[model samples]
Target: MNDDLKAAVLERCRRMEIPLVGVASTDRWEHPPFLPWMPEEFYPQSIFPEARSVIVVGLPIHLPVLETSPSIYYHELYKTVNTLLDQYTYRLASFLTDCGYPSVFVPRDGYGSIEVLRKNPVAFFSHRHAAYLAGLGTFGVNNTLLTPEYGPRVRFGSVFSAAALPPDPVLAEDLCTRCMLCVEACPAGALDERDYPEGLTDKAACAANSAELARRHISPCGICIRVCPVGEDRERYGRTTAAGDDDPRRRRAREHVRKYGGL
Candidate 1:
């Protein structure tokens, strides 16, 4: 029965043009040994006590134009993708509810209110990591999800469901070979050379720089995503497609770029 449900969900996702999807027990994220930035109240168990499963979905962000003008396009693309994810999650929750299962849409605001952040400074856990553990994709050094087909060009969203769907087995693809390309590409030096248990990110620095960029109404840096070898390959495929070239991969890539700008 679980397998049949998984098949149905995957087919729906494919039809929706969502390239990556998975399921993970909500218990995993709600475990006691919490990581930094993971506020206890943010856990599924805390927010949706009855949620038994989470359906994670990943949409590729393969927009090459954003990379070209990082200060102008990245934020725009991110906002678009984030909005799309919100709508998608809401729709999925409605679908599950119609099917006689309880569902909820996890709020996307990572930065808590000033009062909440003061109480819990590290309130934004590695959401991308959580998405990966949910079997949606693999983690890259840049702290982004690297999908099998789209590398780090993806955004993740999930639906918390009361139904007990069998969890998707975690993926073992360690695509980040520690090449340090992402670290090198980070203009803000937000990536550390040493890998910490929580991953190698200078979250404070990244956030500060991003905030500053937001103030200026410019796109934040996407050098890490742009310089990634896998990202480059995806970009190549996208251009080919947009130009009406012979390669179907290129055509698909082009369409993605036209829609999202860049990752």
Candidate 2:
């Protein structure tokens, strides 16, 4: 493994102010960590033949900003985070290539649009899964990668590099509490009480809900991640309680924001 290359990559990420980063060897994908693993086509090596290491980076979504679900405020924030992920990953890939290692960045969202997702829900690459193998976090009941710092409230992007950088160990501890808060709070009834694989989200329903929200100019409905109590983010934001919309003042504020941003 190239320890110096890994150090350089870490330095680059630090300079970019990226909070979460992890690396995984391409060989890790060959061994399934759990049952019902993704097909070979989704593997980094499959997509990019030159890839020897996969570097994944994540950016957190502030809990306070995300509290305004289905509103333009959160919608814009989601877009901004995704945009940054793409740019950061792209720049990192360029850096690695310049260092004599061929590399390429994977876009944050591979799909074209919600309409496209409604018909075909799967992305060409799964960053959450990549984030998982890279040791950034574990999977949550909400089907999101739960990080210690941000839980499911983080977006990820990946870079495929020919450099065989030192890989981070997969987190042995599962971060999910399996409280089912995400399942119960889902507006579209897309989630189930069971753990992932057995309780995989209903992508069709999720896409439909997003489609409706898009019509209102507020695309994503981030209720599941908002209600999740994992990560120190909730404590940091003073949102320890899962009871959202119970406070009249906060409810009114959310309503006020929703009214102005969309139809």
Candidate 3:
């Protein structure tokens, strides 16, 4: 039955253009760092007490075009990924319901009210971590999931189901070491040696910096992703930028010029 379900899910994912998929036991992920948003009673087992399995899907977000203008392009890419994820998640949920297995979408928006953020500083466990725990990829120093194929260029979504499915054990390798390439590349100074001594991460700092970048509108930097050795190696990762190598912020203002052959 597990094999049949796995095959069916894979087929559906392929049809939907989701490149990666994995499954894990909801039981394995019911604790503080994992379930930071919900109370203990709202754990997967408690909420969907019968749910024995979870199907995790990953959609790659590494469009070379995003690298050209990290601020604008990355934000736009994030929106696109979220839209795709929501559609795929709902489709999977409906499929499970039709098969007589109940399912629900885990909350994707990481931020909640101020009270929630204060109470749960780690309120948002890394989405990539969820994907990794579900055996989708290895954890990288950037605290992003690094798949063998796409590296850190992906977004994750999961489905909890009552149907019993064999679990994919956690991946063996911890791809991230003390190497702080991601830390060094962060223009926002959000990362530090002490916070992620062994590459654990401080989510709040990262979030704050990201927020500031959005507020300032000075070419939101995804330098971390750009410098990630894994992503750099992938030939498919290339960027489209305005001519003359001006700063991305300036280049963006003249995007129309480049497109229409006007200066």
Question: For this target, which candidate reaches the highest TM-score against the unseen true structure?
Answer: 2
Candidate with better TM-score, 2 vs 3: 2
lDDT-wise, the better of 1 and 3 is 1
lDDT of 3 by residue, 1-263 (tens): 47787778779989998878888777676643332334555456665667788778887766454454444556667777887887887788778878888887665555654345545665433456557667877766665677766667677887778877787878776554445667786766656564222445565765666556555442335666655556332555333221213356645653632243111
Q: Which candidate, 1 or 3, would have the higher TM-score against the true structure? A: 1
User: What are the clash counts of all predictions, listed in order?
Assistant: 10, 0, 1
Please, what is the whole-model Cα lDDT of each candidate in the order they appear? Answer: 0.65, 0.91, 0.63
Best by lDDT: 2
lDDT per residue as tens, model 2, 1-263: 89998999999999999999999999999998997899999999999999999999999998877888888999999999999999999999999999999999999999999999999999999999999999999998999999999889999999999999999999999999989889888999999888877789999999999999999998799999988888888777767577455567777887788787887
List the candidate numbers ranked by TM-score, top first.
2, 1, 3
The superposed Cα distance between candidate 2 and the true structure at residue 88, in angstroms, equals: 0.4
Error of 2 at 89 (Å): 0.5
TM-score of each: 0.77, 0.97, 0.75
* Cα displacement (Å) at residue 255, model 2: 2.5
* lDDT (Cα, 0-100) at 134 in candidate 1: 79
